[model samples]
Target chain A: MGTARANWAFLLGYRFYVAAFFVFLAAPLIAAGSFAFNDSLFPALPWQGFTLDWFFNDTEPKLGMFHDRRLLRGLYYSFVIACGVSALSVFVGTCNAFLFVRTDLPAKNFFYIVMIVPLVIPGVILGISILAMASQFANGLEEAHGIELGFLRPGLPLVVLGQFSFIATITSLVITARLRKFDATMEEAAYNLGASRLRVLTTITLPFLRPAMIAAGIVAFLVSFENFNTTLFLVGSESPLTITMFDRMAKVGSTPVLNAVSFFLMIGSGALALVSVLVQRDRTKV
Target chain B: MSQRDIKRLTLFLLFAPFALWILLLIVLPHIGMGYLALREKIGPRQYEFGFGNFVEFAMEPIYWNTLLRTGSMSLLVTALALIVGFPIAYYIAKIANYRTRGAMFLLCLIPLWVSDLIRAFGWILLLRETGVISSSLQAIGLIDAPVELLYNDVTVVIGLVYTVMLFMIVPLVSTLDGMDNSMIEAGYNLGGSGLTVLRRIIIPYAMPGIVSGCIIVFMLTAGSYLTPILLGGKNSSWFTEMIYEQFITRYNWEAGATFGFLLLAFTSLVVWLGLKLSRQTLAGTVARS
Candidate 1:
């Protein structure tokens, strides 16, 4: 009876601990989200009544996030860059999936390790290494043959390349996990049924891998959009949304507009995350 | 085309991109960065190859001191995350029902979906002078005046633990979920206390997860620049800040590359030691996470 009572008390204590842990995890985010509607310029307590001026007003002293030209441009640039990164990473990562899984490549273990090296290295190092290589290559070409490569400069193309360098590893992992589950006998059957290699690939294999690829693309897009450490070094003049927010939070104090932006991001990313989870769950059920 | 030709073409197509990706992005850039670090500016248009940049880093007290501070602080963050995360991971893994487990996992992942910038911004809202915590304290008469909580080492550690908590919890949950409740039950049946059962059965079983989670969290905290700068404010004194100052604020690529290499070396060494001590492979650790 004593042991039973002790066990009950322990369980109750454990439950309380877990509850407190979650509150710690969630308090700041909930605070930031709630403050978006606060009428006060500052994101503090004693809420001065709810207002939507942070999201809609275009006038001074209360400019909306949408009306802020820099914020909008940052959002546009982030969207475009995320698109480019997703497309490139998905395509190349698909190729990587095939290379590591399907093809009879020698020293496969070594190559696999090489592929995931980017995943472990710091993003800042990745950015700087790419920057160093590009600048040196550009300078060398100009010095030797009076040639110039505009794409090597810090710009959208470089940003896409830098992001792709690391983001592809994630897409590759996602696609490879799915591809490994694929039954190769299906491909063998396609070949035996007079389907050419290309036809078999396009019709049999790719169709099976389409869901994983789409999921991977979405993951790639979200990662690219939220990326800051690498993009910080690679961005030339056009800052992405993360960089813009970083500048604002570091330089200027918190504004309700930033809170409004945070709320929008939370909703948008929360929805995307839910969709991905559901999609993966459905695939597993099938 | 002949069958052999088609086969050869396919192999070529498969190998080209993989080789190009490693060479152009991973291999060549690192080599270039190393070479840049080696070069010393002797004249306006002339350069010489040497180890002066690395030597300079070693000779500087402030530089190495900041690196040590970053390392020790990162270690603290990793330890705190583990202590804080283990029980939560255990609760989710062992205590929750199957349906609620899914919901709890999603809740943990939600914060990660938001950008780190906004997450740090959230911390600013809660910890600043006129922020929620301070204002609330003032409101309730707990304090006469608001106290600034944003720019200190403790706050930086707290923010970092928050940032990397998900990494620790996911690995911990994945490993703990695989654990059999019977082992824990058996330990209890053998007259072991709860703490003893946890130490003897649970921790040993979850060792790989713990090690992997620690490795990832340590690497992240050590390399992190945003949280330290934002939460630590002017006194951040983080090593990443030094590298950033050299590269961007001062236009000293050589110095920046050297500092970057030192950081990379230190982190790699620690990760290697961690793997060695835990008897875990990098592949297993990374794939599980």
Candidate 2:
């Protein structure tokens, strides 16, 4: 009887715990989502009659966020940075995966350990550190060589570089996971059959890595698109969606339009994520 | 080309990009910052090498206190995330129907695709004085008036937990899913109560995942910038904000560099302690990260 009672208690506790967790997870999203359709200027309650004004309203006193040039430009900047970072990180990260899996190097583990340092080190620190390094390098050039490279300035270029530092580690991990699953014997067999190194790579290894590379590229783009902490310090004048949205909320104060932006992001990310998940699921299944 | 020469060339071709990128960006930046951290900045473009910044940080009660506060708060968040996340992870990994597991995992993953700024914004929309929770409580007659809930340590911690909960959950689920079910069944079959079975079998088995999850959550929380600032407001006194103040507001990169290193050192020390306590290796943790 005691054991049965204890079992009942455990089951009840488990159900309650799961229910509360679901609430905790869904509450903020539901509130923010509801505010998207809210007619109220502020994203607070009182059930201001529903209107779609915040999303597409482009007139004075009710200008929608979509019509806001600054916000749109921020989104454009996000795309540019994400594109740059995804390309650079995937290229270098794939190379790293190849080297780590395919070659013997001096202190390979040490290289790996150092490479992943950006993973644990906070993005803020990484941002300022790079800024410091760039400034010092620029100072040296100005004092010694008399050349000032404008690219060193905090801008989109710096934002890309700063983001790529860590995102590259992520890309490498994804590619390397795929790399490790390949049999070395197959490569040796190709080589023994008189295929050139380049032929083996293009014809065999690249095919094996394509799915992972595509997944990594998509993820890298998303990660870069949403990066905030590092970009906050590294960006000069331009703002991405994150920083622009932050400025809107913290500095300019809240608006329902931010809710509209949130809703838009939800739909976009949901669609993209659905595609990526399906692709990844298909790859793993096959 | 000679065979040995060809092999050397191939090796060089394979490694140059990664090696050069790491050296140029990752290694040099920290070295530069370390140099700046060691210096004394007195005037524009004028500096001297010294322990002055470190000394200043040591002397300032505010610096130490903020560090202590941020560290403690991160610990609290990490603990809370573990308690809240473990059961959910267990449910998804062990209890959920096998066919629906993919859907459940995707559900947990969906929020993370949103930016941290937006996630914190969601909290602000809910917890503000004029926000959803307070106004709803009033509507339901649970409160006499709307009481402000924004801008406090609790709110900040909750935001931190919310932002990084997926990080904790992913590792825990991965670890839990890899376990053999028979071991758990064996414990149950041995007349062990549920708690006893969990204590003797499940928790021990999930220790690496727990350690890795805690380390990642703690690192991210301790180093977090957005949530504390947005939710905790001015009195957040978060260490990263101080680093930001020195870097941007004060234009004192010297002090900011020192603070950055301080955060790194402090977090590494804590992570080292966690690693020691859990008997997990850094390499194991890196795989999870």
Candidate 3:
């Protein structure tokens, strides 16, 4: 009876710890989501009466949120850049994974180390390096050919390039983790039965890699979207969503509009998480 | 086609994209950065080949101080993460029931799914004056006034640890999951106390994971710019901040490239040493496991 009582006591203590951990993790997100509906100008202290003014109403001069055209543009730019970076990274990363796992490439280990170097290198450094190279290229182009490439002039293309530089590494790692489990004998047998390499890859290997590829692509998009260090250096006058939000917080303190944006992002990410979980479940069952 | 020809062609096709990516993105930029680092800035847009940039970095006390501070802060954060994260990982991996373990693991991962910007902002909300921590303290009469918590090293360290804890925990859990339970039981059965069993059996078994986790956390915290930028404020300057200023405000590419290379070299050296040590320790643990 004493041992049973002691076990119960221990279980209760552990349950409390777990509860605290969950609360700590979830409280901020909940708070941020709730604040989106707040009518207050400042996000700091006293909560003024609840209103959906930030999301819907635009009657007030300084208060209404949807009137902020800057935020809308930033969001649009972020989506476009994220989509581009994701597509490019998925293509390059998938090819890299195939090479690493399935092919007989010489100096595989050496290339693997080189590939992962970007992961260890800081984003700020990568950003500056790319900026320097692009600026130099632009200067040389002006001097030699008397032409200007506006896209590469520390804005959209540069941001995409900076993001893709490292995001591809992440995608490659994820796909490679999945590929390590692949049975290559299937591909070998397909080849022996007169199926070409391209057909075997398309039908067998590509199908196997689809889930990991999707996950990697989503992760790459999110990483590029949320990136600040690299994007900050490369972003000219125009801002990405994260950069815009950060600039607002720095200059004029936090606003309910920021909270509204956070709320929208939270919902988007949560939906993505739900879909990924369902997809993973289906894949596991298959 | 012959088998050899087919194999060669297949290898070329497989490696083509990756080779191009590495060549264009990684190799070419580093080569450019290296050249820029060696050249002296004659003016805003002009350069001449020299080691003046390296000399400038070497001569600057502020640069060295920032580097030292960044290293020490990273070390402090990495140590804190290991201390806090190891127990949770051990519990999830070895003690918890299967159902509970999944939930607990998810708890650890929730912080990771949130953006770092949001997480840092959350810390500000909790730590700033009239924020949650201060308000609660004031309500409890623990202090007469709300304390200033932002724009300091304490907040920076807290932010770093909060952001990087999962990096340490995930690797440790993966490593601990592979450990056998019977060895720990045997230690306890042979007149060993709980502490002895933990210290003698479990920790040694889990050392590789711990080491790898520490290395990863250390490298990440050392290079991280956003957490420090947001939480550290203007007064608390990290080395990366200097690089940012050079590249952005001053447009000093030479100096920025030099700083970047120096930071890269430092991280790579630490990684090399860590790999060497972990390989030796891991060999022993692998034999035992």
| Top-DockQ candidate index | 2
Collision count for each candidate, in order: 0, 1, 0
Candidate 2, B12-92: lDDT as tens digits: 998899877888888899999999999997777788889999999999999999999999999999999999899999998
- Give the candidate number with the greatest lDDT: 1
What does candidate 2 score in Cα RMSD to the true structure? 1.7
Task: Please report, in order, the local distance difference test score of every candidate based on alpha carbons.
Answer: 0.89, 0.88, 0.79
Deviation of model 2 at A3, angstroms: 2.9
Q: For residue A18, give model 2's deviation from the true position in Å.
A: 1.6
Question: What fraction of the true interface does each of the listed models get right, in terms of native contacts kept?
Answer: 0.60, 0.71, 0.41
- TM-score of model 2 relative to the true fold? 0.96
Q: For each candidate, what TM-score against the reference?
A: 0.96, 0.96, 0.91
How does chain A of every candidate compare to the true chain A by TM-score?
0.95, 0.93, 0.90
Which of the CAPRI classes, incorrect, acceptable, medium or high, describes model 2?
A: medium
The candidate, 2 or 3, that scores higher on TM-score is 2
RMSD of each: 1.7, 1.7, 3.3
Chain B TM for prediction 3: 0.92
